[model samples]
Target: MMNSRDFHRSPSFTERLSGLSTAFKMFPFIQTGQRILQPFLEKFGFSVQEVTDSVKLFLTNGHPALTFPFLRPPNNILIGCANLLGSKSAPLQFSPQISQFLNESVGKDVVYVSFGPYVKMSGVSWYSQLVEILTELDLRVIVKVDKEFEKEFPKSVLPLNWAPQKDLLRSGKIKLFISHCGNNGKMETIYYNVPVLCIPQFADQPVNAELVKVKGFGESLMKEDISVRAKEVIAAMIANHGTYHRNMKRASDIVENEPGNARENLLYYVEQVAEMGNVDYLVNKVARQQSTVEMYNLDIVVPVVVIVIVVVGFILYVLLKFCVYFSRKVGMAGFRKLKNE
Candidate 1:
């Protein structure tokens, strides 16, 4: 059901921010110290007031924004809801499929390559470079390319139009993931405890890639350097597999320990938003808080008062000059009359 048209009709920045603010209002605990920026929505001429109104409507109407499956409640407030499949209780059915593929391989050295659902390799020049790099590497590759590019790849590169990615990752054969850094791909990589080589193309992919680096899960490569970087990173990942595995296991454990199921988390926030009705209370609370105190705060207030005083003094000076000129004219007229008499 998701198509190019649906993708192109993506929500504006204002809409996204408003939705996030509403989510935050619904669950204030989700707000980390980090500021959430919604400038893109504002750039399109959406005022903060208008965005707030819309968010109010969405919350009151019981139409919380669609979220991902893996997201749990307080986590949802912070991370927003993930797709349904991403839920914590979601079955680990995909892992076995990947395991079967790995069992067929002679060694436990395999690379998983996927550009994600939204991205395709049919016309992209990088596809050929990726193929060339994988051919040179000492590992088997399981690639998920567009159906159109199936014939272009070699036999060693196990090409599928659409592969069971989650299953494949859990198969234990996959040594590293050459990914486009999609959320689903990132989560799957984390869930299966697989190391990644992120090649982010657009949207929140760069953010996800940064997260990967921060988490010590893997390296990020520029799309332009797919050929050279892929080979190098792949070699490094293979060489440091033990470290990668350790980091991945740690991340998985952290995710697993989080409280509540993804659905329970999502519904809890949604119910909270319904109860709160609007973001007015949250916004007011934030506005009233003093971020920091400054000694020169009073000095800033004094300048406006000084400017007003100067403007009023100038006006009075002009009025007095006009009165003097009129009085002098009248006196001169009287003196003229006396001389005539």
Candidate 2:
């Protein structure tokens, strides 16, 4: 679906995923994007005969998804967000608690912002500036920082270096989740039906952010114009909860309503792997290779081209010889007639 055209709306006019074979690896594969990764990682000349594409497998076992081409649907997958069922890496251990900041929550009043482990804040000043901007817009924000972060803040802002992310998002007060849009973060934000405000830092984050934007549940922005864009996006997400929440609910419903849900699918494959290092029957043994001729069709096309060129050249050479021979024959006959006269 990705490497084709007219179906997906590209963010930039010049950017098209259809031409980029590895681009799909960044799209949400309805779970954690492990499925997308296998194809991409394999494109690097590494032969990974993977098994599944859903995020459930990765989160549950840190497993790479299997490469099953036929079974996957052509359209975007519809696994519900909540099927993850708020499974946090740990519990709600740190907080002033998200609940404490909820009196004005219209789902937009409070925002949660954390750049995951990979993205470092520019410095303490940048962190301070971010907190100041949100509070200036009359918003309640909790920023996850380091244990040593000691920025002074107004009572409305809670700047904790750490907090229970799943707990905060589950709190009804959390209207928006501002993050780097990592796959795990995407799963958590969407599963809880919390809308997103993404500022992607690196790797697949940009692709993940684009996925969120396309889903109609959230918005993505460049790191530039931080103060203005943050205010603009936060206001929009809060004010238009009707639209965003509806889309979020629809996506979650699909996941939650699955007959046994994603967990069963993940377990099914995992158990099979345990019984046999891999289920030989399930893995596609056919390599997608083309014989030198089958791949480029050089055997057929090359010979045909060569034959045409030879035939054309031969005809031209004969035509030139005939013109030369006929002209000489006429000249010799004319000379003989003149001598006789």
Candidate 3:
């Protein structure tokens, strides 16, 4: 799992197999995590089974179009919750430098770059190469950087302590987004129909980056390969800008034009849960209620398996004995004939 976490290229057969093996290995740890959280979960009158059951409805801020098509979600999973917290937020107020950059640059000639809060750019090995590439690009760049790295960028690039990321993505000025591919950031880019160049660092970021590429909304950059591959990728994205925009627009429409509103869906489910007091019936209670032995039917299976093995062994033993006895009888008859002669 760790091996595949930062893979920038398409996964190979070995990597896919490793992922499968990792998934199998993850269940026990997931169960252990559930057990560890049992004490806190019990306070809410929920058990490990109830928390882990498939019947339990999951409300995510993800849209169906943004998610991989191969994923088969259960009926209880209510996706496309992108705007559950209301569609819009307070308008973003950009700094004087940022505003000036946006005003001066032609529409779709500006790029917004951010790695979210957790990842520090200073520690990244390809940071210098990234800065150089951004500087050389004809497009105007707005980068959210740590204060220490602010002086590293040239005056041509606008380096700020922070920027209104989601608002900027929504704004018509941003031509491309250079992001860490965090879930919220990825969702925002998808929602706004903004093409992205993913520079995923860790966690689910790489997977999200891969999905972006697979969906044809954008491409991804590896930490190690950023120096070597960044320019080529950025050039390709620039050349194929319209195609990316169209792909993203289609995805955005899917998320936006879905039949029901996410806020309404959330409210309806909440009301149902409140009225019912217990949503256990929604899940497969029989499977959850079963003991480990009963779940796998080891009680019945183990005995049957053992009995079959023993019975086969006994039959083989009896056949061996009969063969020995028959051979001895033939030998005695031959010996008597020889003595008589």
Candidate 4:
């Protein structure tokens, strides 16, 4: 359920450094939380970190394009296939109003906007501004908001508390998605090959939003800047729609045809453990047995680092000694020659 990058082993050096710095900065808050929870967790016989460490397997629901494309996870970890590729027998039924709106907007590009259920924009100052911008766009617009806010927008726009998001994205009429960039929404858009205009609110949404841009399937804007930049960003994405389409289409193809099937992988592992009656072979014994120091290779790292420093120090000492000896000898010889002259 975590972002794949959190578990990814081989990040670029700069990214690794940045992660290390973040860990350091957050260490104090982490320690404080641990201290507050230590007494309560002692009753359960393990700490917070131990919960994840004790797990025998981690099943992630995403394609390798969003996970580790070039590398495989350890035996204990399984990258499950994208959920969109799974069962879709019961498709979401759209309301009559929404259905009619889609029908009338035929032959025109549609933009689907939803911030997800968790985020409420009713109190935000920019909500009205966003509605105004949506009203002005010539493209057909479908926005998901509370029913109370529905009256704020013109009749041309359709505002519902909920939208058949997956169905609409799959409808092919939706050329762009305006989203808060939640993980599930991002994956759905990717599955549907629709470009996104991300205005992330918080948490993993920002990370997902950045990846949208990095993957070249979309662009991102800060939530605060949306009131000012939303119109321009939307127009630009629509103008360059082809490039985004191609990028997302490639991703969709990879997820559908990726070498290891996500569902199959999960089922196989479960069946294996059930038949064997234990995960002995699957578990990394050394990893589980090791303390934090050894787990990070800090035990080995510290000594190796000390050895390197000592070796370099010894080399510098010898070089200095030789230089001093040579200089003295040359100076003495010159003095003797001068005395003779």
Candidate 5:
């Protein structure tokens, strides 16, 4: 996820042009430790170009045509737009339990708290304290998790194991959403024009949360600061009195009512690709075409890996040999002592 400056605003010519390169694709990203060694693979003469050609196609899950048109360029990225249907449809139903919780919260103003379906509240004290503050402010709370809590919670709070998030956010009583700032949750908030209070939980969450603030849809607080800052942020947004609400509504209309909205463009591309028989000609390139140095580098990497393995094996061997030698000496000494006794 890019900042609004990179999303709605045009990128510099360099960034746009760099989009054509594979290195640029991972530029906004950091490789996890497992993949951190990937740069060394490049030193082995492995071509990222070949890897790029091997992966047939890539697609995004957002409706970029209307939501973020700047994504239209760089040709490789396309919007699959999974949320379009949910946005265009009615609220969802997860289970009787969540439905009943909604029933119990009829007249109260709710600040729905969910860090996506997969994320959960890891801090019991912080969460419990946040609940106290919200209820004291006369705002009800909904904490969505994947499992039931054994502890009895206050009447002002609803700890639902699961929820039809789109439906719940659209419900008239919802005043604010406390979310993980995941893309799907962000889209739902946008769909319903629900103001958000983002407590992003890593990955692209921080970026999405920043967008929520940047676009004036809501505020954000780090999870670490939630204990001290959650009440402050929540109060500010709930009291927004129409700023976040109005801005979000305007954003919703912009994404949905805009000409050539994402849904249509997404379908057009799908049909076009389908008509093309799912062929990606780029993947058809010859793998053997390479420079002498690039090809020889594979041989170089083989020895490097093998030499490391050999060194490790030799160290283990010496350690084992020492253990055996010492054991033999101790055994002999013990046997001699026993005989003398």
Candidate 6:
């Protein structure tokens, strides 16, 4: 009784009701439902093959499927700010304005703190407690306070809404980072080869925190008893400087060695796909050939030759033009001399 487009546009009453019911339920129920439905859908030809193929492609390209790519085998995932070869290890630089203040306050013993952007300090009472404990320690603190806590903390606390985090980490002035254990921050700390005191809020944070402890980079504190835990953890971090530095160095090495820049790798893959007309076999073959050519230094030779030729041609053209102009001038000068004679 309806056109095809109209029929497709209209959601079934049953589906609408089901969606409404799901919305009213708790978050856990929605997650449970998704988990249950995912396997069923995959089995019923929803996305099984596509998912498998995509994962295979990533793995084949030297990417890790689970865990931080910078942490484990294949060792081709790029996720840090340091050079992998460790050829040029240097201290991180912080904003000059804050650096002066930090140097004056803590001298060579300052602590950096960040709980990530999403984790609000207002909703978490432990933030205030942690601040108080850090202040009591008489340590110079660079705490990245969220918008909610901006007015709450005193001006002298070095409270920042956002910071040049990587630069600060690389700065030798920062002795420790109190983090939420987010992967980016974790990787940054690793790249800077700095120790961390993780205060996990939720999600993968607990897992990351555990890994940090396991890897000996640093320790984690309970979010609830932030003050007490932070005090103990900070003491531990300061005392056991050797282990943290060593672990961070090792992590930095791995991160630096990871294969492929995200942009470069992604564009390479996309270009490959387009060039090969989406033929998987052809794409693989082309990639293999390109790798071989690169290894053998074959592809570079032609481009270098072309560049040289172009440069030489330009120089020759200019020289020829100069010669032609001089010849014409000489010819005119001889004629004028003869006429004058």
Better of 2 and 5 by lDDT: 5
The alpha-carbon RMSD values of the candidates against the true structure, listed in the order shown, are: 17.2, 13.5, 13.0, 8.6, 15.5, 23.8
Q: Best-fitting candidate, measured by TM-score?
A: 4
| lDDT digits (tens) for residues 1-341 of candidate 5 | 21223344333434434443433343343233225435765888765545554555555555442233332223244443345544546646557766676678777677888766665565556666666778888887887755644556777777877766777877656888887888788877876878888877666677667667767888888868976777777877777838988887776776667667666766765776789865354232222354443323433446767999999999999999999999999999999999999
Better of 1 and 4 by lDDT: 4
Clashing pairs in 6: 76-259, 84-256, 91-170, 92-170, 92-171
Worst 10 residues of 5 by lDDT: 65-74
**By descending TM-score, how would the candidates be arranged?**
4, 3, 5, 2, 1, 6
TM per candidate: 0.59, 0.61, 0.66, 0.69, 0.62, 0.56
Candidate 4 lDDT score relative to the true structure: 0.72
* Comparison by TM-score, 5 against 6, better one: 5
- Error of model 1, residue 291, in angstroms: 9.0
State the weakest 10-residue window (summed lDDT) of model 2.
61-70
lDDT of each: 0.61, 0.61, 0.71, 0.72, 0.65, 0.62
Output the TM-score of candidate 4: 0.69
Model 5, residue pairs in steric clash? none
Q: How much is 41 displaced in model 3, in angstroms?
A: 12
Clashes of 5: 0
Sort the predicted structures by lDDT, highest score first: 4, 3, 5, 6, 1, 2
lDDT per residue as tens, model 2, 77-100: 223232454353335533345455
Q: Which stretch of 10 consecutive residues in model 4 shows the poorest summed lDDT?
A: 1-10
- What lDDT score is found at residue 200 in candidate 2? 77
Model 3 lDDT tens row, 95-188: 7777787887765478888899766776555766676786687768888787667446666678777897867887778888999998888888
